[model samples]
Target: MWELRHRGGGGPGPGGEAASPPREGEAAGGDHETESTSDKETDIDDRYGDLDSRTDSDIPEIPPSLDRTPEILKKALSGLSSRWKNWWIRGILTLTMISLFFLIIYMGSFMLMLLVLSIQVKCFHEIITIGYRVYHSYDLPWFRTLSWYFLLCVNYFFYGETVADYFATFVQREEQLQFLIRYHRFISFALYLAGFCMFVLSLVKKHYRLQFYMFAWTHVTLLITVTQSHLVIQNLFEGMIWFLVPISSVICNDITAYIFGFFFGRTPLIKLSPKKTWEGFIGGFFSTVIFGFIAAYVLSKYQYFVCPVEYRSDVNSFVTECEPSELFQLQSYSLPPFLKAVLRRETVSMYPFQIHSIALSTFASLIGPFGGFFASGFKRAFKIKDFANTIPGHGGIMDRFDCQYLMATFVHVYITSFIRGPNPSKVLQQLLVLQPEQQLNIYKTLKTHLTEKGILQPTLKV
Candidate 1:
């Protein structure tokens, strides 16, 4: 009994000399010859018990359960295999989501901004939840609170910038908002500093590493969800078509790829996403390019869809009306000789946006899936089948939007690179924010330049 106690108690050896702790390379042992092994392990456990207990958080092994068919559908399609059942569930939900999306679009730009915010919040929650689950840091003080606090700080910063940039006229009328907008970055930074100080104050000794890990995790999540969602809203303000075409291309690719893969997939595309295939990837690329071209053509014809969302101070509301940009205006393009010979046409008139859509569609098809695959690998790392069970068949909102976020970033980059040019409206918005003296100086400078160019009649000084 004393021997048992000695072995288990992690105490000194029978010899007065203390037992050396087991080497890091050696494993736990059983034989009496190595009786000290168990004692050494016990000593190590005692030394780091607090961390070991929390760090051992492993998700239990469970089979993938992506089916998640709703009860009514399950009962109705009870005869079908799980694969077909999932197909039905996903298809119905996809259409429902698209319909709801159109409804939001009809409700107008404010509603679309709200939708982006909602998705951003949900995605942030899903990712933060995963971090919490992986770390099992429930005992860590103020972590969940800090995560949410940082999220609010980020939203305030991004949305504040959006209002300042896109709603300058509207903001100018509100005194309280004017102050906030004037010093938006400083306020955002102060808010973040408060969160950072709270985090430092909340740190516990044993959980220091884990706490810092969660800190980094929260910031990375904000970068992914908040930053990309802001870019999406920026795309929306460019024109509804700017927002819609890229997103629709991704959706088109995701669906067509899945459908093609379901029917014809053989060679695996990537180890990260086992089900993705070369056949589906190729099919999705062609389908998305076609879909983007057609959608751009259709949307470009409508002033409402093609116009930038702008604040109309006269109407005291936001509006989407302006002369369509060169992008939306139809232009003639000369076909290459071979294409001209094949099609029997020398030139084709098309919206410049339709030509740009080909690039957007190509990225959505070829590169967008990598975003989804990255999410899949993240889940695999954590032994999770899904981010959350929010959507019946879609896993979570993040699952559906992973590729969309990637597409949004790409579109924003593409616009700045190729599509967007100097905007008179944006410059006017900046002028509106200036003091009267500054505005007058700019006006004088502009008038003088215009007079020199003979575009404006010069006023004689009295």
Candidate 2:
């Protein structure tokens, strides 16, 4: 009994000696072998007791619990307690960043594309780092190198497609770029295959499970970071308006949700984000819709906002000078019965695109918040504070823009499915890339079809 007490309760003697104090009741003449074995057992326990017990200190610095600061402190800080002060500081900084972003975008679309690529790379870094820190315990081989190689391959595949799709005219004209552009997919696949072979070669017989786990992790991270951001750049090519409006709408919604939640939030919305409230959700939706409408109406007047983006080779720049599509043009619509009765107007004229803001804003407020919730769940799953403390108060760039990426994707899909039509310029650019004989065949077919429709005239002496 005294031996057990000595081995468990007593840890170490003074002067860094690995000695457990013998209890007063124990005999001094115990076996040397037993004493040494007991001492070693005690030493092992002392080293790892806290980790084994899963102490509070071992938990994530920022926990899964809701932001639940005391009422007294909140009142003391004038309701700016529990991260609100941090929120204001970050918010101001964010607005400044947005202003600078627009200034860069004003310079050229190329600059904006560079900004997006930089952000994509940074976000990928934050996520991949988290996975490495979490799963590196598996002792997987070539994990970091393989992840980076996959990122390179994916970026090459995506950006190459973008250049080919949007800048085909410039590509076909360049002798050096034609081969690369024509076989971009094959090149991307070949690069990926090389990486795949390397990963297989690095796999150990005993570590196959760990190797496969890291592989899936790398691929999933790529999907989340790369695919969504690609859609965002695609939205930019449609016109800066599509990109700006949806992103701004999400920002507006997030701000209003926090404002409303702070003042009027009572009923919790979700367990994942316990501070969220139904009041905040509804209030933000209404506010976002109003903001989207006003913003869309004001921007439609500017060619820079309403015009489709087109490359102007003659001017050696990108330009937004196309005639407003019917979507941007004003059209008559019947009002609701109540509005019609109150205003005594049978019909009202409004920019048709302004009405579309309702859908965009609706998604921004409703479905977009789920993206944030999804991110919250991901952080919680990893037992992490933030992906990285990229922004002091808010968290990482991922934390701030989780919903914005979702909104951008939705906007792109909405425009393509419902609003976008085939572009004559793009069609002509593709035709220009074909052989002369092939071009002649298309021309003959078009001429015959147009003549059959009485839209083309036969040659006649003037």
Candidate 3:
């Protein structure tokens, strides 16, 4: 076995440095030594050990100093904290948006109804211009102004009666013509003829194709407005419900979309609207259904106000006094046996008011969102960020009213088709059958009798 010698100080003969050679019995000790040459250099006591022995006081000592933070670093950290504190700002923004939304709904309810009518008129005018553009390839100076006046007349002719009837007492005597000739009919015809002449004249100007298109577009627009207007008016959906359904549906859809988008919106639904997601669509769909049900329930409860019930007593009395002309229409009409018996008993109840809530909801959900989608597509097509930045975090009039337009038309159609009972003539016949005029006379007679007997107060109408 090799032996190893321990080298503490100078042991080598050549340079007086430590270099102990391995001995036969110490070879295992050399193998076990793991310290490298670099470790030996870093050991501080190696050189000092060769010097004369020194006391502990011979070395100088240094004390530790405090660490100082930079002012710029402190400011940077503060800024990061402030930037992250956005909760309060977000809350304030949300509240403001909600308040403005309700305010718009309140004022816009009536304004939107007017807007719908106006859009129809304007769209009609645009269509006429489209025709002129197609046929003549350019606009006539007076065409716009003339179209406005023409559309106004047509609107007044169709809508004036129903709108005036809403506030019947405010209506002037001259506005009460139900069956009078429409004075603007000739002007309307003349405008159409003039447009035709303009189209023909364009042929002389080498723009016949454009002029033909202009006339064609004008007529097409006119037809569209006429059809839509007829549908809306005939349905008798001009009241507050017109505003409520659309507004409610849009609001509900928006809210539900937000809720779902916030929670589960991991994937985008469409590239055009990146924020829209499958989660949001599902949420909106369910929310729309809920709103529909609520609207139906509320409308049903208030059906009496929307559509009043007319009661009839004593069929014999009604028939005896009803006009011969009215009797012809009443011939096929008869009340249920039970209801007739109840009417004969002079009961107050005859017809219970009914409202179609489910129908209203179905229409709102199906048609309302299409309006929104179309508006979205329109914005995408135009390459616009939004309609306008009028409402913070929201968009413009077109953006807000998109869904409303479709919803209004849908509910109006539903009400017209199913909710409104039979014709007015039938109702009038039933009222006449009760001998309303005779009953009024008898009532007046009783009133006089009661006054003479000191049982009632007498009053005179001016």
The numbered model that scores best in lDDT is 1
Q: Give the count of colliding residue pairs in each prediction.
A: 0, 0, 26
Q: Where does model 2 exceed 4 Å of error? A: 1-80, 137-139, 422-426
Measured with C-alpha atoms, the lDDT of residue 213 in candidate 2 is 65
Instruction: Report per-prediction Cα RMSD to one decimal.
Output: 6.9, 10.2, 32.8
Model 1, 390-418: lDDT tens digits are: 88878989999999999999999988888
- Candidate 3 residue 395 Cα shift, in angstroms, is 3.8
Worst 10 residues of 2 by lDDT: 48-57
Per-residue alpha-carbon lDDT of candidate 3 for residues 75-151, written as tens digits (9 for 90 to 100): 54454554332333333445765676556445633343455566565556434533443223344444555455545
Backbone-clash count (model 2):
0
lDDT of each: 0.85, 0.79, 0.48
Model 3 stretches astray by more than 4 angstroms = 1-143, 146-150, 161-239, 267-275, 298-356, 385-393, 421-462
The predicted structure with the larger TM-score, 1 or 3, is: 1
Best TM-score among the predictions, by candidate number: 1
* Model 2: pairs clashing at backbone N, Cα or C within 3 Å: none
Q: For candidate 2, lDDT tens digit of each residue in 1-462?
A: 344334466456677776656743463778767777766666654543333344344544433334443445345557566567656665666777778877986887768778888888888888887777765433677888889899999999998877777777777778878888777889999999999999999977555655676788889989988988898988888877787789889989998998898889998999888889999999999999999999898887778877767676678778888888887888899999999999999999888889888899999999999999999888877787667776555667788878977887788889879987675555765787789999999999999899889999965769
Candidates' TM-scores?
0.86, 0.80, 0.47
